[model samples]
Target: MKRPERMARLARAQRALAEVAKAESIAANARYEDSARQADEILDALNATNVLHGFAVKAMADTLRRNGRTTERLRRVADERASQYVRQERTAEVLEERATQASSEARRKEERQRIEILVSSPRRR
Candidate 1:
């Protein structure tokens, strides 16, 4: 009877060890799954950030290109307008010089006519 009791106690100890091992395995599996989920979330966030940065950089490049084209066009227009102003000033100077020459010629003709009229008229004694 003493030997049978000892055998029964050993069987109960074996069952307790098996239950503890199974519980530990279940907890370890749960921890691994939680870590996997966190890793996947981090990867997704990194991908999204990379895509946004790419778009922002592209937009900035396009804006700079457009500004460069606009600046070049404005410079061309300024050059053309400056040339036009110079042409107009030259034309005004030519017209003013011609008017001065015509006035001088008219004065000389009037003075010659007055001298001939005085010489042709009879003198009063």
Candidate 2:
């Protein structure tokens, strides 16, 4: 694809990566809140159902930990993709610069050849 299009895609990918990290953080926080609520419920039910409350709290805590780890993994993936896109953008820009330089050089060479031909050719009397 063209350099400008690649640049645009790179910007969008960077933005999306930031957004993914933010959203995962929010989700992880929500999981923590839910775990806290479960702990509170367990306390409230301590006298009436100690055994079941303990099990419920344990399960909720485990789930929260797993959710946090999953979010971290997902965030890492997003960061990797962002870096890949950045590399792609740099490559595209480099190629575009080279192409522009090559075109300029070609034009200069053509102009020089034209001048040489004109100078060497015999003029009409």
Candidate 3:
């Protein structure tokens, strides 16, 4: 209900979002790496001289080209996701810091109020 509490909750949500973004970025990068490995295998297949079927080699070459494009696209997606994750993480950090400051300020205010009350009250002998 308080400002610090609300800010803390928001910071937690942002951290969760950042974690999801980080996972997505890692997955994208893995997919790109796998695609690249497949393209390399296709190249190796094309290099084999004992291939009986010419059409198969042509098909493999075409597939390799397509895979190259896909890999590039995946790389771009991974980079974008990584950047998004960084931004989200930074936002979360800032929110957390602000929440901590607000909480400290609230405590100080309460302490001051308590001190004022104690000082103004008369002690009974």
Q: TM-score for all predictions?
A: 0.50, 0.55, 0.94
Summarize candidate 1's per-residue lDDT along 14-46 as a digit string, tens digits: 445545555555555555555455545544454
Model 1's TM-score against the true structure: 0.50
Distance from true location, Cα of 10 in model 1, Å: 99
For candidate 2, give the lDDT. Answer: 0.63
> What residue runs in model 2 are displaced by over 4 Å at the alpha carbon?
1-55
Clashes of 2: 0
TM value for model 3: 0.94
lDDT of each: 0.56, 0.63, 0.90
Instruction: Estimate the Cα RMSD of every predicted model relative to the unseen true structure.
Output: 49.6, 8.3, 1.2
Task: Flag the better candidate by TM-score, 2 or 3.
Answer: 3
Q: Can you tell me which runs of candidate 1 are displaced by over 4 Å?
A: 1-56
Alpha-carbon deviation at 38 in model 3, angstroms: 0.8
